[model samples]
Every structure is written in C-alpha cells, then in structure tokens.
Target: MSSKVYTTESGEVVYAMVAEFETPADVYHAAEKVRDAGYSRWDVHTPFPIHGMEDAMGVKRTILPMVIGVVGLSCAGLGFLMQWWMSGVDYPLMTQGKPFATWQAFVPITFELGILFSAFTAIIGMLFFNRLPQWYHPLLKKDRFLRVSDDRFMICIEAGDANFDPDRTRALLEGAGGKHIDLVEE
Candidate 1:
C-alpha cells in the first residue's frame, strides 16, 4: 500500500500510526522499539516517564539549548559592540570631556544591554526553533491520544525520512504490542 504522509499544524511531516496498549509497560516497550528502529522524529506521551524507558528508546538530548546559547552569545557580543561603537568610537560627544574610552563608564550600559540582548535572543531563538506559540496539536484529534496526559502512554514515530513505512511501521508497532493501532491521517 502507498504510504500515508501527515502534515501537522506546525508544518512538520509526521507519519501517523496509532497503537493500543493495555499497560504502561507495553507503551514504554513500544516506544523503545520504535526508537531502535531508527525513526528520527519520534515522541512518547505517557502520564509520566517510565523508569529506564529513555535508555530503551535510545533517545538523545536535543541541541536546541546549545543553539540558544550560541545565539545568545552572538546577540550579547553584537550589543556590546554596537553600544561601544556608537557611543564612544563613532560619535564621541563630550559631556564633561572626562575620557573618550571609558571602560568603567561603558561597563554598566554594556552589561545591561548585553544581558538584555542575550535574554531576548535566547527566548526568541527558542520559540523560532521550537515552532512554539502553538495552542493545539493534530494529535488532539485522536481520541485515544487524549489519554496520554492521563493514565495512558503513547509513542509516535514521524514519517520524517525515506525510511518511514506506514504499513510496515504499523505492523512493527503492533508487533511491539500496540493494541488500538489507528491510522492518523493528516
């Protein structure tokens, strides 16, 4: 059968395959299996994180924090240079003609603006990369998925790459012990 590709509200491609599980353990195990299968964009939704499940799923930490840090540093540096260049180097206005290059005087303003710029960049950069400000997800359309925040646990693998196979993937989830096994079509 031809693969069904789903586009989420975030404009991300997610292959929708639903699995029903009787227990959280089953859900946890299924998530681990899904990850080991090498599906890149995958997620698990459980009432809570199951112990040792992350190891099983082979999940890796996202680099978004590092990206945020670099961008924040860049903003801070730019802010410092802009302030210094404009106030001291570019347009030298003599208030009392104390000193053209006053590091002490510049320190307060520079630090203030640097922190401001860095903080702003960290927030904006995170939102941009995360595609946040979202109020809802297409998963809300799945009745079974609603249980995710409650008693039920779920793992979803996106069809992000060429490796995604809807039919075979569904089979894999089922074989891993998924019960409901619904197809989420975008």
Candidate 2:
C-alpha cells in the first residue's frame, strides 16, 4: 500500500490512515493492537458504544470531575464572599432586623453559582480536552468511513502520532483483522 502525504497551504503535513472493520469486535481488537503498538494519536469509531472497547483502546479516566469540583468550590466561595461584602461591608442594609451577613440568604445564590460554575467547567473542559468545534476531519473524507455513523466500525491512525509509520501501522491493522483500509488526507 502506498502512503500518500499532502502539504497544506501553510506547509504542514496532515493526513491519517483509516482501517474499516466489519464489526465492533474487529474494531475493538484493532484498537487493542494499535494501543499495544504504542500509537497515541489514534482513535476508534463505532455506531454505538462497544463493551470493553475503552479498555481495548487503553483510554484513561478523565480529570473533568476534579476540574469541575475545584472550579465549583471556588465559585461558591466567591459567591458567598461577594454577598457577604455587599450586605455587611458595602451596603449594610437592615432587612426586617436581619443580620448584616445572613448565611441563610447566601445559600441559594452560592449553590446556584456552584452549579453554574460546575456546568460551565464540565462543558468547556470536555470541549478543550476533546478538541471540539472542529468543523472538519481528514477521516470525514473517506467514503467507507461515512458508514461509521451507520454500521461500520473504524480505527484511524493520525499522522501526528509520534509512532505513526504508514506502512507499519497499516500492516499492524491488517494483522489485527482490519479490512477496507483507506488513506485520508487533509
């Protein structure tokens, strides 16, 4: 198989080789092989989630929860402080003879701010980690991959991978039972 390389207008090399599989199991095994082969910049796509596929792909647990927790707690503290400063120091409004810094009155806004911060952190963190807002991908150019949303399963080894070698990678996928292999260019 010939590996085609293309240089972009900015003179950047961008391309990926995609291997199509007949079933989810085939793609799962292919992902295992790719992971064992030490390829980091590779991904597997399937119409639906496959059991054990995450382990096969060597995917690690995401840190999004931790990020959200930190941000949420920080925002909650800030919200409480803002309310405290406004009521106790800045304005000092006496409402029905209530205390200047009312903890009860601050709970709702603090909780809301915490939830809001957590939600925003979850969305933005996920997008940042997953590299979202990408309007195009090289794999989208492959005709066979169009079935990825339907019935086909695919594994793509990106050119940006440190261990990516077109010939060796293709051979590895073939050995792992991949079929209908195609090269995608950008």
Candidate 3:
C-alpha cells in the first residue's frame, strides 16, 4: 500500500497516520494493539475519557504531585521564615507583651501560603506536562477529526516513532476496526 505524504511549507516530508474509530471501545482496543506493537509515540483522542483507556494506551502516572508537594513545602517554610524575620529581627515589634517570633501567630499565614503555592504549582505543572497553550495542531486540519470533540474517536501514530511504518501501522489499525484512516501532515 502507498502511504500518503504531504510536504509542509518548510519542505519537510513528515506525516502522521490517523485512524478513526466508530466507538470509544474500538479506539481503546486500537490503542492496546498499537501499544503492544511497541509504538511509543501515539495518542488516542475521544469525545470523553474512556474507562481503562489509560492502561490501554500504556500511559503511566505523572510526577506532578511530587512537584507540587516540594513547591508547597518550600513556600510554606519561606512564608514562616519571612514572618519570623520581619517580626523577630527586622522590626522586632512587641505586641501584647508577647515574644516577637510567635509561632502561633505565623500558623495562619504559613498555611495559607502553602495552599496558594500548591494550587499554582498544580496548574503550572499540569500545563507543562501536557504541553498546553498549543494554538494549532496538524490534526485540526482534518475535517473528520473535528467530530472528536463530539462523538468520534481517533488514534494517531506519528511518523517519528521508532517503530512506525506506514503500511504496517495502517494494517494494525485496520485489523483493530479503524475506519476513515488518513495521513496528517505537520
């Protein structure tokens, strides 16, 4: 079978093979087949999250929680230190006959800062991990793929994958019950 190729404005010949499935189950099964075939650079898109689809796509758990945990703790500690330095050493204001570095008074601000840092870290880390803020993608040009937001399911295997072969990948997708297979250009 001849693979469709598209030349970009930059004169690059890179292309992506997209297989459209009629149902989420078909896409999920196709993802499993693609994963088992040792193709690492592939993605599944659906109208909504499918049950067990992550395992089918061989996606692993992310480390964003660890990042958030470290950032939050650091911010909380910094907040406590700032409060201590300001009240105990910088200005050394004495209030209600109490010691300047009162741990009790620092608790509220420290907790609030910790929460704020965690929330920020979570949002930033998610965007970073997911590679968001992408205004355009090659798949957006495919007319059939527009239904992915409503009902269609799709799996795209990039040409850059180490194990990618246009004919073999197309056959795999076909065996997995994919329809409307098309080549996407970058």
Candidate that would win on TM-score: 3
lDDT of 2 at 30: 78
| Candidate 2 TM-score versus the reference | 0.86
Quote the RMSD, in angstroms, for model 1.
5.4
Question: Which stretches of candidate 3 lie above 4 Å from their native place?
Answer: 1-12
Candidate 1, residues 1-186, lDDT tens digits: the string is 225565656775554666767677787778778877877666777777678776877766667677766766676667667766887899977878776666667667666766776678778877886698887776788888988777877767656545567678888888898777765645
Best by lDDT: 3
Q: How does each model score on lDDT?
A: 0.72, 0.85, 0.88
Could you tell which candidate, 2 or 3, scores higher by lDDT?
Answer: 3
Worst 10 residues of 1 by lDDT: 1-10
How far off is residue 141 in model 3, in Å?
A: 1.7
Query: Which residues of candidate 1, in runs, are more than 4 Å off?
Result: 1-15, 20-26, 47-55, 90-97, 133-137, 159-168
Candidate 2 lDDT by residue in tens digits, 38-105: 98878998999899888998999889999999999999999999999999999999989999999999
TM-score of each: 0.67, 0.86, 0.90
